[model samples]
Target: MSLCYCNSQKSFKDCCEPYIKGLKNAPTAEALMRSRYSAYATHQADYLVATTHLSQRALYPKEDILLWATSNQWQKLEVLKSTPTTVEFKAYYLDQNKIPQIHHEFSTFVQEEGIWYYVDGEYR
Candidate 1:
């Protein structure tokens, strides 16, 4: 089975490839949010850090992030709403013990040098 999102018609790679590779800027806050979801699903921590605003990136520890990613089976991502600087969504997944869980949040983003970078989020 293949996993894809964002109505991009392309696979996650082809769709969000540039963002993941630091080759292109995310056009909207929602785009950044979706790419972050894909990053979490793939356990691409370096990409995560790269896309996060430097001021807030310190909130997460790399080792703990890797552990969390390894312990979860990411299922799907849903974007409920978004604006130029914020996005609200829910990501569903299963834990290491196979317990299903949902992480819902309203995430904020900022544009720097024409690139969108995640700032922080309010979990809901």
Candidate 2:
């Protein structure tokens, strides 16, 4: 079994695949964050777009999201903290030039109609 891209130590199928495949919704903000990281690693731009909060969707065009996803070689995800509606994490990746980079953020989430959507993030 392939390990989840989110570094959750679970199989991809058991962790993020269901979320990415539209078969299930992430039950919590942290889950959503993990699955979103997995989406980037897998280059599933549509999933990324669909999981963003509606109000912020326009700011994240699918083509741009896809380009960002495909341009990086996602390496790891580190979940530093989580609350009901927030997650702080670091995403490690390699750029197209093969240079290592880290994207650190404290992300906010909101649950609407029992579904969680990523709102925005404060970059660190």
TM-scores of all models? 0.89, 0.99
Off by over 4 Å in 2: none
Q: Best by lDDT, which number?
A: 2
- For model 1, give the 10-residue run with minimal summed lDDT: 1-10
Which residue pairs show backbone clashes in model 1? none
The backbone clash count of each candidate, in order, is 0, 0
- Please report, in order, the local distance difference test score of every candidate based on alpha carbons: 0.81, 0.98
lDDT of 2 by residue, 42-97 (tens): 99999999999999999999999999999999999999999999999999999999
Cα displacement (Å) at residue 88, model 2 = 0.3
**How does residue 16 of candidate 1 score in lDDT?**
72
Q: Supply the global lDDT for candidate 2.
A: 0.98
Residue 85 lDDT in candidate 2: 98
State the displacement of the C-alpha of residue 58, model 2, in Å, after optimal TM-score superposition: 0.8
